[model samples]
Target: VNEILDLLYTNLETYPSVRTWVFQKVETVYTLDVRQISGPQFGLCFNASHLHSEKIHEFLYTKLSSKLERDTLALWNLLISLLAPDPSTVTGVRLTKYRKGKRKDNTGTDAVVDYEMDNENLEDGGKILDHEAEIDEMAVHDLGLITVVCQYLCHIASIMAHSTNMRCNALQTAIGFFLEASNAPKTVCELLAHSGMSVSAATTSRMLGPLRSQCEMKLKGLG
Candidate 1:
């Protein structure tokens, strides 16, 4: 475990500056049984981050007890980085040629949805204006990526569900997405599928029993 941590720690000595943002989601319209009409869209982003290695001993000043938290945060960091733009590889508007600020800021884990890669090694010519048309045609299908994003949503939801904030940010975010112009039910499936997690809505409903009830109680308190 120590050896593994040593290696991983060596890789992230410098907090990554790359940004991964989903520029668009590919929408697919189809019909299920009973002539059910549905329109599903996917969330896609262009990443611009890479990995490197260096010394570790200069960083880990604490003992091994912090190993678990360190590893978990490390994994999350790496995972988010993987969603960013890789210069030598990823090209086009996917490289944040015209975006601004970090979408993941107040968005919790939405970094993967709209990360504007830091302009460290790249030149910012007038190309920013040319990106509109290229990025306007955005939409991707990667359920695995969506799954990770959903977890962030769930985490935020769970937090807001219990927090004293009468206005639930997490709940609001979820509701905004689910209640927006998109197909709510199918979007859930799209996100979960991308993450390779399949827990039926029935199962989810059941799991939400306690949370849902608690939320209702809170809502009532606001009155």
Candidate 2:
């Protein structure tokens, strides 16, 4: 399991040709949709656009929550779909995204079935086993949207980019801050400021405060 996960975290593509647009927003609840133009692959075309911090943060906080089951096919599909494209060996690839319905689905989001076979030709019995559960992300026009897989990969990359000592020091810093407000945790403001962030108290209390709690709750639930 560990090896499989590591393969996914490292082999998955960090960037793809897709743009996310905010579709509907009701109060704090947001429904984001993705619009993609798939060509040959990464080397096929060039569409360079920046990602929106606000949107991507929202996606990570909400979608990448603890709901992801490590033992199930959800992680498998996500990692496999995000796997680096190989136009050479891979015969064909199909991506199917399931939309939100009346009741919330597995992983608490839509599922995408990513199909891939390595046969030289599609005629032979080269069908791969079908895995389940998937997700996507949101962004603005002209700018590219980060896929859900890439988003999680980015999180992993951030940790991998740090040295062992750097990671330890960073965790120690986080622990210190976490212990500081272990009891009556404030949403943002002083805590974040003390952590060397430039977030304003008002903004933290009104906006990020809730968002922080949401992400924390999601993590706690996963545990």
Candidate 3:
């Protein structure tokens, strides 16, 4: 199971297009399972002995949460989709005032609906109004929004550049074979696999020196 999971995480970048679909399908499976187990009519038979078992619920939740965290690229894609301006909303004419409900002519309605739907789906969407200026003002007020957006974009760039050198085979082999291995050996092998390199331990150590130094410098700057 760990090997399978490590493999999935390693090749996640290769399936970028299908990542969203995969996430949705996984969510759907969980939802269906939850519904079947907890539904009123089926609750008794499934209770404790079957789907509603405490152990199973805990395991499922743990797996889902871990997957959500590990699948950073998928989360980044979701964030981009959320932040992107809807095509339907970009109109030549800016209405001086906004009103709710369907427009008599459906020409501009699609854009409005799309924008609203996206906003509504967001975690804090309810707090945000449909006003363009209001949304911009909120974004400006929240420095965290800027920080999060920057971090997400940086992650996307790292994935695109394949900078992390975190790969499936190396991860799986490390987890599967080196459960008892020393940290130094595991780290060295994983790095080699991820980077597709054949460097000696001394060379790998030398390469990390500058990277660590840069990180410390940035930390000091932030401080």
Q: Which predicted model would earn the best lDDT?
A: 3
Query: For candidate 2, what is the TM-score?
Result: 0.19
- Model 1 misplaced stretches (Cα beyond 4 Å): 1-81, 88-183, 186-198, 215-223
Would you give me the overall lDDT of model 3?
Answer: 0.41
Q: Which stretches of candidate 3 lie over 4 Å from their true place?
A: 1-137, 163-204, 208-223
Clashing pairs in 2: none
Across 1-223, the per-residue lDDT of candidate 2 in tens digits comes to: 8775455446546212111111123211211100001111211111112212243223332233232223223333444466655644323422211123312365676554444444443544233212222212211210232354454543432232222123212222223334444632455546644443323343323333454666787899999
User: What are the per-residue Cα lDDT tens digits for candidate 1 across 14-113?
Assistant: 2132111111111111111101100111001101121011111122212211321243343334335555545444443445533422345556564455
> Would you estimate the TM-scores of all the predictions?
0.25, 0.19, 0.21
Which is the better candidate, 1 or 2, if ranked by lDDT? 1
- Using TM-score as the yardstick, the better of models 1 and 2 is 1
By lDDT, rank the candidates, best first. Answer: 3, 1, 2
- Candidate 2 residue-wise lDDT at 109: 60
Error of 3 at 107 (Å): 48
> Using alpha carbons, what is the TM-score of model 3?
0.21
